[model samples]
Target: MAYQLPALPYDYTALEPAISKTTLEFHHDKHHASYVSKYNAAVEGTDFDKMAIEDVIKSIAGDPSKSGLFNNAAQAWNHSFYWNSMKPGGGGMPTGALASKLNADFGSYDKFVEAFKAAGGGQFGSGWAWLVVDGGTLKVTKTGNAENPLHLGQTPLLTMDVWEHAYYLDYQNKRPDYIAEFLGKLVNWDFAAANFAAA
Candidate 1:
């Protein structure tokens, strides 16, 4: 089946104050929807037409001839994952097994936050910062443009979109403030835990 835009788990205004409703509306409805549309168009009549979004991304990634398809398909998948990475009242550290793993892998929750923020903030251009399971070990990584951990044989446990469209309207040019809100008040730890458990 063709790739499609995934619905947000919460209402657009649900993340307000930290993230404005206007930002969600434009980001989800406009930005994400556009990626899905372009991705579908790119795969039309091709072998990727019926492939899963993740499969399509992996298949196209690094193939110069399919760069456009890779960009759109990866963006479509990334945005869907990004939506689930947050919730209205989420964030402020994880717990249980996931919490233990974070401490084991990154020293402590505060250290994880510092590393995550640094990864997100250090992304020089449109990109993402991710916490992923690479070869059964938790690692923090960053990818430029539409790149994601999946393409590198890693399992993404959590991600933060550093693209200007993700925070420009809400935090203006202060990407660090936006990153702080996402980590301090918006991250969906349950979702991360779920991803972690599955990984």
Candidate 2:
């Protein structure tokens, strides 16, 4: 099956005045769409054509010849997760089970935020910050380029795209500010809870 862009749960400007509508349009419509399109093209006529995007990414591993496929497929999955990761009036703190897990894993929500922000901000280039379920514990990690938690046998519960295309139009070169705003005011814990439940 072909991967497609997932619709934003809220309006493009819903994330403003943190993330701009212009950035959302380009990031969702152009960047994410390009990944889906490229993934489809790469898989066409191959045995991997019928594989799920996640499976395709795993199948490709890190082989350079398959890098394009891996990048696009992982990106296709990543962007879909990223879209649902935020919503109107989202952010603050986790509650219920997610809260318990966060505390157990990172000791406190504040610590989690710091680690996530540091990972997102410290990424050398285009990348992502991820909260993943690993070996029955929640952990935070960063992935370069189109890499994702799937490669590490972990389930991504939430992610923040740190790629320049994700924040450039809105935050310019201040990627740290972008990460701060996302964690403080735009993280969709409700969506993340659902992902946790599913995972």
Task: Judging by TM-score against the true structure, name the best candidate.
Answer: 1
| lDDT string, candidate 2, 1-199, tens digits | 7666778878988888888899999988999888888888888888898878788778788799887778888888999999888877778899999999999889999999888988998899889999999988899999998899897899998899998899888788999888888888889998888878888
- Give the CA lDDT, 0 to 100, for residue 67 in model 2: 77
What's model 2's overall lDDT?
0.87
Residue range with the least summed lDDT across 10 consecutive positions in model 2: 1-10
Per-candidate TM-scores read: 0.98, 0.96
Q: Please list the C-alpha lDDT of all candidates, in the order they appear.
A: 0.91, 0.87
Pairs that collide in candidate 2 are: none
Record all residue pairs in model 1 with backbone atoms less than 3 Å apart, i.e. clashing: none
Quote model 1's TM-score.
0.98
Residue 189 in model 1: lDDT: 89
